[model samples]
Target: MEINKKSQAGSLESSDLMVYVEPFNEIKIEVESSVSSQHTEEIRSLILNELEMRKINGVYVKIQDNGAMNLTIKARLKTALLRGAKNGN
Candidate 1:
């Protein structure tokens, strides 16, 4: 059976990021980093992976990272995806 994925709880710290995981949408990304390019890349990669894993396609993602760690970024992305998926955003 195809289980419907619902939006998960959002994190207050990563509340700034708005990621939409649905059909027919754009992938928008914006970063506010005091970190290095490599770190940013890592976070970006992780986000992409998370989206793919959730089987979500065609959506825009806006990330405003404030020197957050990799795990934190992932959590934020997950929350956004869950929210978007559940709310049909």
Candidate 2:
């Protein structure tokens, strides 16, 4: 799926994550987390896995995490990707 414009999902509240996606020539990801020193790689892996599973590429993703768990992160990324796909269509 192609992200046509900026789209977002989730919240900045504790235990939640906000995900933003937009169209790009190549995939670019930026992540900010309350526990970046600990969970940054894990979080990036989760997001990349989700995108790969959906065959999504050529997009820019920005994640703002507030201590969210893995499941929450996956759900939020899926939500944002779906929303972005809809916008593209």
Candidate 3:
């Protein structure tokens, strides 16, 4: 599916996260984590898997991770993606 516009979910609160989704010509994923660099790759993989599972493409995903677990991040990503795709661009 294609993202129609900019959308976001989650927040920068402690032990939480924020996700931003926008329309783009290509899939772009950016991640910033407060935890540690060691978890970056894992988190990136998780985002990729989630996008792949949902067949989402041609969008930019910006993740600001504040020590959130995979489950939380996944939920946020799904919500943001859906919101971004809600209206036709």
Candidate 4:
């Protein structure tokens, strides 16, 4: 669980969230957000789509949000992916 490098991106602007992507060809998603239930579901849906599209696993994502928008969520997810890639995910 070491974040050796952080992508050159801004931080999340909402609640604190942590995502762990396992290594595999399957779509496995786990999210922890401080947003409301509806918003959480929305975010989960978006994240699932992203993970499926990217096909990433064996990596973990941790997000500290501050009321981020859809774009922000995408940015944060990409940042985490970049970081995980750099760190040999």
TM-score of each: 0.62, 0.91, 0.92, 0.57
Candidate with more favorable, higher lDDT: 2 or 3? 3
TM-score of 1: 0.62
Cα displacement (Å) at residue 9, model 3: 0.2
**CA lDDT, every model vs. true structure:** 0.55, 0.86, 0.88, 0.54
In model 3, the runs with Cα more than 4 Å from the true position are: 87-89
Model 4 alpha-carbon miss at residue 19, Å: 6.3
Single out the weakest 10-residue window by summed lDDT for candidate 3. Answer: 80-89
Worst 10 residues of 2 by lDDT: 80-89
Residue-level lDDT tens digits of model 4 in 1-89: 32334333454444434343333344445555566667767777787677667765434344444456777778667666666554544
Clashing residue pairs in candidate 4 (N, C-alpha, C atoms within 3 angstroms): 13-66, 13-67, 13-68, 14-65, 14-66, 14-67, 19-61, 22-58, 23-58
**Alpha-carbon RMSD to native, per candidate:** 5.1, 1.7, 2.1, 5.5
Task: Give Cα distance to truth, residue 10, candidate 2, Å.
Answer: 0.7
Question: Model 2 misses residue 88 by how many Å?
Answer: 7.3
lDDT of 1: 0.55
Number of backbone clashes in candidate 2: 0
Residue 13 deviation, candidate 2, in Å?
0.6
Highest-scoring model, TM-score: 3
lDDT of 1 by residue, 1-89 (tens): 11144333333353233333333344444444455677667767777687678766665565656566676677767666655664544
